[model samples]
Each structure stands twice: as C-alpha cells, then as structure tokens.
Target: MFKVRVLNEEVIKQVIDMKQVVGAIEEVYRLKSNEKTEVFDMVFHEFERGVADMDIKSGHLKGEDIFGLKVVSWFKDNEDKKLPMLIGTTMVFDSKTGMPIGMLNAEYITGMRTGAAGAIGAKYLARENSADLLMVGAGHQATFQIAATLISMQNIKNVRIYDPIDSNNAKKLAESMKELLKDKFLSKYENTDLYDEISKKFNVNFEGVDDLEKAVKISDVIITATPSRKPLIKKEWVKKGTHFSCVGSDMNGKQEIDENILACARVYVDDMNQALDVGEIEIGIKNKTISKEDIICEIGDVIVGKEKGRLSEDDITVYDTTGIALQDLMTSKIVLDAAKEKNLGVVVDL
Candidate 1:
C-alpha cells in the first residue's frame, strides 16, 4: 500500500510523447467541459517581488480516477548557480484510495501540455485555411509551441519567430526548429515520424523577424509565449480572421497583447475564474475595457461542442491560457502509464 514510482526528467522524456500528451489534453478539456474534472484555485507566491515566484496548481480528474498537484518555481538568477531558471515537481494520487502513486519532474510535462493547449486553440479557433504562423517570443516554450503547432496543424507552411528582448533569440530558435524538422531529431517515435513526414511533404519555412507589427499583420495565427509585463502586440496591427493563442500572462502583472484586441474579438479562456485573475484578458477586465460577460465561453466548452468556435471568417478569436492544473494532472497519468509499461521508473516503498 505504500509503493510509489519515481520518475525524473530523463525518464519522463523517454516515456512521454507529445502526440499522446496532446490527445490526453484534448480529453481533459472535454472532461472539464462535461463537469467531470475540477481545477482548484491556484496558489501563487513570490520569493522576491519581480525576481522569483512559485505556483501550486492542483486538480481532480474524477473521470480518470486520479488527482494531482504541480509545484513550479521560477528564479531569475538561478542561471548564475548553473541551475535551470524554471523548476517543477508533480505528485499524482489515486482517487479511490487517496494514496500517492507517482512523483515526477514537471518541466517537460508543463511545456508539452501547454504547447498542446496552444495548438488546440488554433485548431478549433483559427480559420480552416490558416497557413502562416507568427510566434511571439523565442524561449524554450516557443520551441514546444511551434513543434506542437506543426504536429497539429498541417496547413501551416511558414513560421516566423520574434523575441522582444533580442533578435538573436528568435534567430537561434528558428535555426533550432528548422534542424528539428529536417532531421526528425526527437526521441519520441510518433513525433519523429510526424516531423519527418511533414518535412518531406511540406515546404515549411522558419524565419526570425524584428518587425513585430508587420509579422502580426500578415500572420494567420499568432502564439505568444513571452514573460513580458507590457503589451508586445497592438490591436490596430492585428487583421480580421487572425487567431491568437495568448500563452503568457500567467501572473497578475504580465501581459502581451493590447486590451483593445479583446474588445472586438471572440475571447475564450481555459478557465473563466483563472483567466479573469491572471490570463491575457485580465488587463482588459481590470481596465473596464471588457467585462466578464465579454468572454464567449471556456475553450473546453468549444471542444465539447457546448459552444461554437470561430463563428465567422471575419471574426478574430483569442484563447487566453492561464495554465490550468487539469492539464498537468491528465498529462501525469499518461507519463505514469507509459513509464510502467516500459519499466522505466524507480519504485520506492513509501
């Protein structure tokens, strides 16, 4: 009754595939819409204001018979000590027995699940013929976002990356993505095969851009994954029928798009309460530019057919992702299941 499996980042990398994780996330969303899952209120704390912070995200997946919590922290100066700036740990429990079943490193799961969320947003909300994508922010998360997008949306033929802090970051990420697609360089079988097939079939192009406005205007889909506190994209620059997956702004003060965009767009959130508190739409709601009623519905609602996504070709759609706990919980189960089949994790008596 006290045995627990331990999975480190390395083991997690071997067992969890992005394609499977994407499917898991899609199921989680549907479960959420059907009231079969519950995401508890996220608890956030800052070690030092503006320097470091931590968040505890917990949820119950009643349909899956599991529940879990993920603790993620970000330390701005951790690089000075040769530590990753972002670190996370996730604990999973059996719902029926209420016993801890698994513990694992959460960094990879965090990135992949969030990437899937962004891609799913585009899949449901973006125009059917959407081809060009502009990624706003060229960080580690940006790579996963692009990979998941390519895996989910085969129509995307061009990807442009922009980092407000430096153009070099965008250039580096562009090169890395191009190499990844060309070589099918991932360890996961499904992802590797998909990348290889995509590279051979599509003339995919990746570019690093300095002109954010021009990139936004021409792109069919724009995904932002930065940690910016101010708006990096303007409302006037955005064209009609464009879809935006706002992946940043998971904190009280962080923002990426102008609030004016929400005024005219059909906005959807991962969770209404979390979105109003810390998502891309938070600023707009705070400034009275948009109210809670402005949000059409949760993305899960659309996924479950409870609501429509992208009502018209001329309608702008925005998905405000606040990083829900249900995503981590569902993805953890996938990793745990895979690890068990391959006998890839360490088992310890608790």
Candidate 2:
C-alpha cells in the first residue's frame, strides 16, 4: 500500500542539500541531453500592482520513469505584510504506472536548485582559473549562489557582493553568511575552533561593492539575482573571459544586462524555448539584437559533452536560466525518497 506522501520544509531542507541538488540537477540535464526526458515550456502569469504583486508559474517534466507538475508563486512586497515572498508546492508522479508519489513545499527547493543550476553552468562555462566571484544581488538567493559556487569552484578567493536595493541589505547578508560559516565550523568540531581555522578551508573574503561597474569588471564570474525590469549590467563594463549567470530575468521584459552583451557573448540557456519566451535574452530577441540563432545549446548538452562551452580563454559566455520544471521534479524525488526511508513525512491515502 504505497500511498502519496506530503512533506514539510524542515525535512525538505534536511534531505536535499545544495551539493545533492546540484548533482541531481546535473543528472537531469544529462538525461535531457540524451533525449530521455521531455519538459514542456513554463506557463507564467503575472498580476502587478502598486505595493504588492503575485505571479503564478507552472510546468511539467517527463522523464523515463518519473514526471511531475509544479505550481509556484512570486509574492512581491510581502515583506510589508510580514509574509514570505515566495510560496509554492510540487506534485510528483510515476511515469510507468501513472501513480501519485509525492508532494512537497518547493520554495526552498526552488532557490537551491536555481542556484545549483548557476553553479553547474559556471563549472562548465567559467574558466578553470576563475577566482574572483561577484554577486550582483545580495538577497536570500545570493547565499545559495555563493554557497554553490564555493562548493563547485575550489579556487574562489574574493566574493564581491552588491544589492541594487541598498548597502544595508548587502552588508546584513554578508554578516549572516559569516555567522553561518562559524556555526558550521562549531557544529562539527568544537566551539573552541577559531573562525580562522574554518576560513583556512574556505578562505573567501566578502566585500560590499557600491559601484556596479567595478563589481562587474573585476570578477571572473558574475551572478545576477535581482528582480530588475531594466538592465543594470552594461556590456562595456564586463571583462573578457568572464561568465555571467543571469538568474533574475525569468520573465518577459525583465532584464539585468545590456543587450549588446547577448549579441556578442556565446549564449547558453537552460532551455532555448523558454529563453526566447521570457528569459534575459527575450528582450534582446525582441530588439533584434539577438535571436534563437545566437544561442549555442542548452546547458544540458554542455554538461553531457554534446556542446562546447567556453571554447577559448577570452570568450564571454552568458548562461540564461528561465527556471525549468525538471529541476523541481528531481529535487522533489530526492526529498521524497529520503522522507520515505526516514519516515519523516505525513503519509495519507490519495
């Protein structure tokens, strides 16, 4: 009697770490590259207002043995109302038997898997000697970007973080991450271990950058994580051989970089269909600056060695991700499997 499982956030976080999420996402990308999976384009609906706004995004992922539909929301300006800005859920099903398997809270999974995609992209696209990393938006998602990059790129030394919103927000996030690192060190060994010891393993320094040009120019990798409708990063400011992971521009008319960047840079998207529909490159396509022809291939193809990424040391590559459904389904499978083994979720007849 295998009934459907409904899970909680506490268990969700415990089972699916960023490293595992990255691996799962990379595996799913491999499956996609091999044509062993089918994922429909995303369905996004937005309702804008003065102070608060909400949007719904839903999608379907079909793999050889599994598939699912996830519906997530973007609740902007929820801070003023003292509520979470992001809230959503995912339902997973077995492909062979058409049986319901699991459902879960997908808010954290969304952020972690998205950041994992950025990290995975950087692993394939960023230079092997890349060290300087810049975070264009230091919000809740910023740490995930930093964390995943730290895990993926072993040589990163400097982390320059900026939030277009303000300096206080950036500074506060940096402080919290430092606390997290210290706590992580203390939890394993002992409280007596100096923070310096922990820093020895991950000796990356964080700086709050107020100048956007300097932030973009000095880094080997740039990750944008803001909800900006207008372009904030300029083409002339970026350095050669740098990789840009554009994560914030997941909707049509929302962009974070100048169109010229997309015109010349070797572009790789998580999904080419979704990229043209509502990714950062969508505006470029609309303006005739770039089109579907400019895209090299999906990140999955690069991961599976079907496409080349960062062919030369001086090439500039942009990985445009529009938040795919396969990512959510893979992450949910990991959490669901762990929950079933640990008996951690609420089980009910469905």
TM-score, cand. 1 vs. native: 0.95
Off by over 4 Å in 2: 44-64, 75-81, 181-201
Best by TM-score: 1
TM-scores of all predicted structures: 0.95, 0.90
lDDT per residue as tens, model 1, 1-350: 58789999889877776677778888988998999998887788989987999989999999999998999999999999999999999999999999999998998899889999998899899998899999999987887788778777868889999999999999888877866644332445544546566554335788999999999999999999999999999999999999999998888888999999999999999888989998999899999999999999998899989999998999999999988888998998899999999998999999
| lDDT per model vs. reference | 0.88, 0.81
What is the Å distance of residue 304 in model 2 from its true position?
0.9
User: Which digits, one per residue and each the tens of the lDDT, describe model 2 over residues 1-350?
Assistant: 56999987877866666666778888888888888777754555666644344443433445547787787666677777898877788888888887989889988888889889888878889998898998889877888788777767757888888899898778777667766644432233344443344355356788787888887888999999898999999999989999999999887689999999998899999877888888989999999998788899999999988889988999999999888888888889988988888888898898
Off by over 4 Å in 1: 181-187, 190-203
